[model samples]
Target: MNTQALGVEYYLAGMRAALDDLPPNEVAEIMEDVEAHVAELSTELGENETLEQRLGSPEQYAQELRQAAGYPPRTERLPVTTKKQLVTRPRVAAWGLAIATAVTLLAGTAVLRQSAILLLPAVLLVLSLALVHDRGPAQQEIMDLPETRKIQQWLTPEEGTPGERALTYLKSLQPAWWLARAGLLGLGAVLLASRDILGFLFIAGIAVLSVFAGPRAKVDRRWLWFSLPASALAIGLLFQVIDVTANNLAYSSSRQVYQPPAMQSYENIYAYDENGKLLTNVLLYDQDGNPINAPRQYYGCNGDDPQPMIPANRYPRPKIDYENGSCYTVAPSVVAPSSTESAPPSSSGSAPSNSVAPTSVSPSK
Candidate 1:
């Protein structure tokens, strides 16, 4: 073999590695065409382009090949497909993009509802995804292509344990699952940032690890166990943080007034002036100081002389008849009465007292 053939052989090897995630037979089928293409390219060396220049890197070329074969981009290598477990699967990237667009639109609408203009981007993303995976009669449909089914049949396993079955199911929907996972992670990051930057960064780091783990999950699905829990934890913490932050914000924005003791009833209570002094013989007046003789409907209580109702548990309770003016007290003056109005002063120089015999007050139930 000459130098050109050796180079072609190396190139083919790289291509094979790039496609290693796929089933062996599929890779072999692809290489046959690649070998022919390389041979043809070698003869056209004088056409102002080297093979590498014309075709680009092997990994990139492999991505193009995968897409051309009606598969998703080679972002990660999945478990190898086989002959026995035949199945059909959708193009992973298309469905992934479709689901991601939907999730982003929902999240964006929730976070950015105040800015109607921002909704345009989300709408456009949804429409584009719809167009890409569209199965309607109006446009060219790629999802139902025969090659997609053949590839799925090659990937599925015939018999498996519960874990293996679950893994197989996941592998079928892997692309969309990852995208949905990423979308949830992004929402978590946003929520975390709303409360704490450090928390958001921590969750972001975990998310990065989970993303990298996607490719290797085909080898050992232990990564899924770790990643799923980590994701759940991050999301839970983020939601908690956001909830606390929202509550705090709401509390801070309002005025904090002191609450009185629970038993201090204000029902049927007397009103007082700001200085804690009682208003006596009070008369109703409007802002213009005009006498307002409104009907009882305007004011729930009647008299200018207001009296407080006795506590519900008080013994010998006041007969408070609502229809008539009972259990009411009216004070003639705000100050103590003059000495001249009272009975003749006691023989002693001291003022007389109006005390009555002590009576026991019963405790409230």
Candidate 2:
């Protein structure tokens, strides 16, 4: 190739690399337009005038095209020597702080559950936000970062590679993930609020905001301020829910025997007859002929002198104030018992006339 042709080819190669992030078809069309333009310019160039003198560097040319086409400005890859210098840039530092804050907040709140450790991330987040606001226009600087490019290259690997396939699969699931994130956020809110309606609504609003902001944040960095914190809180709440569920399951499994629902709260059983008279020494049984048991081993007292009552189906047990050395009988109403009679044994399977049924009373009541 002649000198002019070689210059054109070299320019196009540089422009191609600059626009690597664009779609292949779009890149091809852009290259064709630039090639035709450069050919015309090469013909008009004097002997000593180069394409770089006429059109500036290929990176600069590509940037002009991007601006004209209403595309975001591309970040040209910098050499390894300049990477350290770029890391100290305010925009790059802000992004680094933002990432560190997110990771620390998530780990501290959800995994570590340590409030003392969370102060650092909180301060970092505030500093990150301040830097982002002050630095202005961080998207280009962030994209130009060495770490960012490495991540992009890793995610967008060579075709047919396992990384590429995995990336493709993950990209396909993006819509589903977006929906799941909102749902999970709402669920976490509900769990954290103990199923309160107001809490659900508040988190649900944040979830909705996140769903919309998540996509926009890719193009617009400002949305990060809202989206990041909301996501962190959602993830923390989800972990909290998981921890609570696991604890409940462990507690339930530790108990060898199941306690009946009716006996869960009440410790003593009381029996009453049809005439509103209290019945004493009444034995109770279930339909299956099983003795209905009470919850506690001792009853009828409140202190160290608690009366040891045998575990039986007896009802209308006396209430005793051990401190006062007094035992008192309880009735359903002001009416006294007709007599101190031992009622006949009763079964839940069949109700007999004058058969007194055992009733449970909670300790608080």
| Every model's TM-score | 0.27, 0.46
Report lDDT (Cα) of residue 216, candidate 2.
74
RMSD of each: 18.6, 14.8
Residues 1-365 of candidate 1 have per-residue lDDT tens digits of: 23333366567667877886665446655766787798788787764555676687777788888887896556554435421224322233334344444443444334322323324433544454444332222111222335544655555546676756876787788766555656666666566576666646755665667676666545433243334444444354445547667989877765355443345221111224555444433455569966543111112234643354223222112222233532233222222323433432232211111211111111121
lDDT score of residue 154 within candidate 1: 57
User: What are the lDDT scores of the predictions, listed in order?
Assistant: 0.47, 0.60
> Number of the top candidate by TM-score?
2
What is the Cα-based TM-score of model 1? Answer: 0.27
Q: Highest lDDT, which number?
A: 2
What does candidate 2's lDDT look like per residue over 1-365, in tens digits?
A: 23355487678767877886665457656765676789899899898888988898888888888898987777545534543464454455557566754775475245333333444555666666665453333343455456766777777899999988998999888667667778777675555465355645566676788798778776566566666665676667667777888999988887646653443354445565765455678887899998886554333334464544544577644433323433333332223434436442233211211322222233331
Which residue pairs in model 1 clash with each other? 81-154, 81-155, 82-154, 87-153
Error of 2 at 154 (Å): 2.0
Clashing pairs in 2: none
Candidate 1 yields a Cα-based lDDT of 0.47
